[model samples]
Structures are given as C-alpha cells and as structure tokens.
Target: MDPSSVIWIFFVFLFFYPQVLFRYRLLQRYKFIKQFEAVRKTRAIVMIHRQEQLALFGIPLYKYITIEDSEEILRAIRMTPEDMPIDLILHTPGGLVLASEQIAIALKEHKAKTTVIIPHYAMSGGSLIALAADEIIIDKNAVMGPVDPQIGQYPAASIINAINTKYTDELDDETLILGDIARKAIVQVKEFVYDILKDKMGEEKAKYLSETLSTGKWTHDYPLTINKLKDLGIEVNTELPNIVYELFDLYRQPVNQRPSVQYVPVPYKRGTKK
Candidate 1:
C-alpha cells in the first residue's frame, strides 16, 4: 500500500473507531443491558422513533413500518416482567397499515394507557395507528392526514401523455395496451378505495370517502395539511408529549428539536372541557 494511504488509514481508525463502535452499539452493550433491565423495572415511557425505512422511487412505502435495529424494542415489548406505561412517538407519512396496526395492538394490549404522541406528523396508515391509541397528543399545526387511503396512478401525467399520443400521433397496438392498462388502473384504484371503505366509517362512509378522495371529488391534492385532522374530530392541541420533555430537559439529546406546539381549540389538559 502507498505510505500516504497507510497513514490515512491509521488516522481514520484512531479518529473514527469510537464512533463506529458507538453507532453499532458495540462499546455500550453491557451498560445498555444493565440499564435496560432497570428501565423495565420502572414504569418508564418507551420511546421509539419510527422514521423512514422503506421507500419506492423516493416515496415512503407503507411496508417500511417494520422496526429496524429494533431488537431492544422487541425485547422490551416481550418483557412481561412488569407493567410499563408506554407512549409511542410517531412522525411518519404513513406506510403499511397492517404493520402500524400490529404496533398499535401490541401497545394497547400491554400497558394501561398507550398514548400516541404525534410530535410532527402521523398520516395515512400512521393515522390508523393513532386512532387505535387511547389519547392522541398533537400540536395545533401537527398534521394527521385524510385516512382516506390513496389508490391511484402517479404523475397522472402518464394518462395525459397516453391521451395525447392517441390524438396527436397515430397510436399503434402498444397504445392498445396503454388503453387497457389505464382502464385497469382506474378499476384497481376503485377496488382499493372500496376496501378501505369497509374498514373505516362503515360500508357507506368508507365507500364515500374512498371514492371522494380518489376521483375529483375533493380535488386531487397531495400534502394535505393538519387542518383536515381537526375536521376529523382529532383533538389538535399544543400539549407536549413525554418524549419532548426528555429531548429538551435531558442532556445528550438525540433529536435536533422538539416539534413546534401549535395552539388549537382542543384541550391539552386531561379534565379540561372542550
């Protein structure tokens, strides 16, 4: 190896070896094990940051809801030694509904109260999990989405292109394939929308919400804001979840900043009247 390359490697190992060990958690394994035992003994709130894990073409796939580097969490969940009050802090754009539902059922079955704290956003399938929680705490501006499952083709621009092709240039047999695909895409979108109807708001409303969101009913829009969750009876408030307490209060915090608490009509206190 070149002498410069060898020297660089030595400096890298010296400077970054500790960080590598920490990231992999090799250095603190024993200490963490002991602390894990202690935390399990007390009724401490369990904090899990389920950020993006799965994506498709830059879009968050619902299936990424699975826990990664979550053996500690899995162990904690399985530790039935004592009852520990838990709070799940979720900030997701929504992925797979079932993955979220499992976490919801697990939290609800174990603790006395499983409050889902939406520090920033809990949308799509994430919203479904929030619905399962006993209490949902979110800032007034904190968003939760339409629960109206989106089932549609992306870039509806493709459909537009196909139409233009047929009109502008003489479309051949492949155009026939596009015709069939576009038709089926519409039907697939409808079927998915219909299925979601059966799950939420009963058959009638699910059907309506699905159809409404899919078609031009509500106007095809993305990035629906926090205001809509307010309309859905979710108590949007400025209350802080327990995780935020530790983030600002404790030393060596991981997250950059606490979510901005937005004031809304919903009451943050336990007994306050709406």
Candidate 2:
C-alpha cells in the first residue's frame, strides 16, 4: 500500500479507538442499571449493614442509623406505589434512635402490608424497625434484640441506675445532667416502641412488650430468639423465604478485602466528545 494511504488508515484507528472503548463501558453500566431497577421493582427493600457496603477506612459505617438514611428510605417508599406490598430485608446492628424511629414510622404508615425478613440478626434500632412491620419472618438462627435506648455509647437504663446508686456528693453536674437526659430518653423510647406495636398487638400488650424491651431487663444487646419473640406475642415465622437468602447472597463480601472505589462510565450523547 502507498505510505499516504497507510498514514490515513492509522489516523482513523486513533480517532475511533477511544470511542469504541467508551461504548463498551457504557453498555456494561446500562446492563447493571437495568438489573438493579428490576430488583427494585420486585418491591423488596433491603437494609443490610454489610461490612463491604458500609465500611470506610476500615471503620464500619452505619453503626447507627442516620437521618440521611431515613431520607433515602423515604425516597424508596415514594417510588413504591401505595397499593404494592413491601418486603423489608433487615440485617443490622442498629443505630440512632430518632433515625430508626423515622424509618419505623414510615414503614408502619405504608398503605399496604409490610413484612420484615430477618435472615440473621436485627438488633437495637433494627429491632425497633422490625416491630413496625405487619409480619416478621426469620430463619431459625435469626435473632432480634432488646430495643433499649442508648445515649451516646451508654445504655440509658444503666446510666439512670448508676445515678440512683451513687451518692449525690460523688456525682458531678455532667453526670447528673446525663442521668436526667437518660431518664427522659428511656421513657421516650418506650413510648415509641409502644406506638410501633400498638396496631399489630393491642395497646396493653404493646405497653408490656415495650416496657420489657426498653427497661434493659435482659441487657441492651440481648438476642431474642424466635421462641422468645413468639412468647412476647409477636408473630414470628421460623422459615425465611428463598428470596431473602438470595438477597443476602447478592450483598455478601469476600473476607479480608478493603473497600475500594468503583466507577461506571456514562453513555455519551452523539454530539458529545469521544
């Protein structure tokens, strides 16, 4: 071939190579987005606190529920039609009290039935959210936990009890103030729990369960098994649906891997740069 013809061919390859690569990346992203939308359309809302999804600099994110998370959940609820049933998949160590309450209330107020599926554990605030569900489905090995409120890192009940035991001279202003706040928090949390349970269980039964869960009788992190929950008048299903396990499988992470950034290319418009 002529040298000029060879040079023209090379220029064309250089011009089109990046465009080809960009299109391939765009196609992959489009496929992933479609799959995600399909899953959302299934009416399953998952709140799994997986280490991979929540880790930052080796620290676990969402050790407590956040206000931002409540907003995201609200958005998801908005996307769901009022007549559609909601299936909530919960696996978390729990988080902020107010944040949890927001999500719990939203779930409770949903027009259609809401079912909570616990494949493993839903502790603390997670338990609070579970209480709002119309039905709870759990595996035999799954656990729910006490709904006692925690102020900062200290359990509210413990803080109040400590104040009662300690002499006035031994307690500083900060300690006294915290104890007062904890006392009020304990009452507030019990009220919230009662409200969450009142519609499913009667008011009296809800009150009893709320008192039992919030007074720290079994400790804050006490794991309530299926039998215990049944005794408490909660309708607990020992058999978890296959879809719950499949969801967990999708979110599972490999052991010993650090969190990393992920990038997906956006499809370019026809008139956009290569």
Candidate 3:
C-alpha cells in the first residue's frame, strides 16, 4: 500500500475505535439481559446491592433497597404485561422494611406467577419479599435470614424482652414507651409474614413459620438454607439451573477496577533560539 493510503487508514481507524468499543459493550449488556429473560421464561428484575462507594462529589452512596428502588420496581411491573410472569433476581443484605414490603406487595399482586431467585444471601427484609413469591429458588450456598424487625440497631423482640424482665416500677418512662412500640412492631411483622405465607402454605403452617421467623427464635442474621426452609414447609429449590448461575455470573461485581484508555494530547514544542 502507498504511504499516504496507510496514513489515511490509520487515522480513520483511530477516529472510530472508541465508538466501536462502546457499541460492543452495549451489545454485550443487552445480550446478557435478554438471555436471562429468555432462559427463565419470565421478565427478569435484578436487585443487587453493590458495595458502598463514594460519588463524584465524595458523598457516600449506599446500595440498599430504598423507596426509590420500590418506585423503579413498580414502574417495571407496569411496563410488563399483566399476563407475563416475573423472576426477581435478589442479592442483597436486606434494607428498609417499608421499602421491602412495598416490593413484596407489588409482587404478590402481580397477575402472573412470581419467582424469587436468591443467588447468594437475601436476608431480613429481603426474606419478606421472597415470601411473596410463588416459588423460591436458591443455589446450594444461598441463604435467607430471619425477618425479625429491627428498630434502629435493636431487635424488637430484645427490646420487648428487656421490658418484660423489669418490674413496672423499675422501668423508666422512655423505656416503657420503647417497649410498647417494640411489642406492637413484633405483632405487626408477624402478622405481615403470616399473611404473605398463608396463600403459599395453609393458614396453620403459615402462622407457625411466621411466628418462628419473626419472634427472634434465631439471631437476626441466621441463615435459613434450602434444607432448613424445606423443613419449614416452604417451597424451595436447592438445585439452581445453569441459566440462573449464568445470570448470577453476569451480575457479579468485579473485584478489580475497570481498565480505561485515555487520549493525551502531545505537547507542541517551539524551535529553540540559536
């Protein structure tokens, strides 16, 4: 090839390189999303919690379920046809109870079958949402935790117990007030869990599981593995399909920083004076 032609081809390739790379990455992301939906035979929604990171302005960003997340989930449900099933891909340490309940209600009310896939651990409020699903699928290593409500950092049951151990005269006004609130919260959470489970299991079994899970029989972070859930009469699948693992792999966070290439303009030099 002629030197001029070679130079022209090099410049043209350089001009379009970044655009080509960007389009390729976009296509890859689209393919992964579509593949997950296709394999599951349902509309897939992912709720993964990323590690906390600092934003561009140095503000801390948390990746827990929030009210905004519930709004987005509702929006997605609205966009999907009523007859279409949904598969929720959950990978969270759980978050706000109110937010989780909002999602759980939406999922329960969805016209089609709903399934929750726990790729790793879905604990606390996350378990509440999973209870709304028709079926729960988890990897062998995946776990669900007790749904005992927490007020600030204190477990509701613990607060109530502390009050019970003290005489009425020994309790201060504030302690009595907090104990009352905690007792009410415990009842509310147990009732919510019972309602969610009643349709899945019979009312009797649902009531049993709900009380057991919400009354702090186990620590808040206790892992309910697939076998344990099965023993509790919950419909749980231990063997995850290959496609589920593929989706999990797609959602896995990278341990290392992403590499980037940036263009730096060459400094222009003036001829030195002799």
Number of the top TM-score candidate: 3
**Candidate 1: regions farther than 4 A off:** 1-11, 14-63, 67-75, 80-83, 150-227, 241-274
lDDT winner between 1 and 2, please give it. Answer: 2
Cα lDDT over the full model 2: 0.74
Model 2 deviation from native, Cα RMSD in Å: 9.7
Can you tell me which runs of candidate 2 are displaced by over 4 Å?
A: 1-42, 52-63, 254-274
Return the TM-score for each candidate structure. Answer: 0.49, 0.75, 0.78
Which residue pairs collide in model 3, if any?
Answer: none
Summing lDDT over every window of 10 consecutive residues in candidate 1, give the lowest-scoring window. 258-267
**Residue-level lDDT tens digits of model 2 in 1-274:** 9999999999999878657765554454345433433553435566667554333356553334667667767666666667666677778888888888988998999887788779999999889989998888899988999988888888999998889998989999999999999989989999999988887788999999999999888888888998898888888887675655654664454333211111122322223221
TM-score: which is higher, 1 or 3? Answer: 3
lDDT of 3 by residue, 40-158 (tens): 65677777775644433555544677787787777667666677777887878788888899889999999889988888989998899999998888888899999998887899999
Please estimate how well model 1 matches the true structure, expressed as its whole-model Cα lDDT: 0.47
Arrange candidates by lDDT, descending. 3, 2, 1
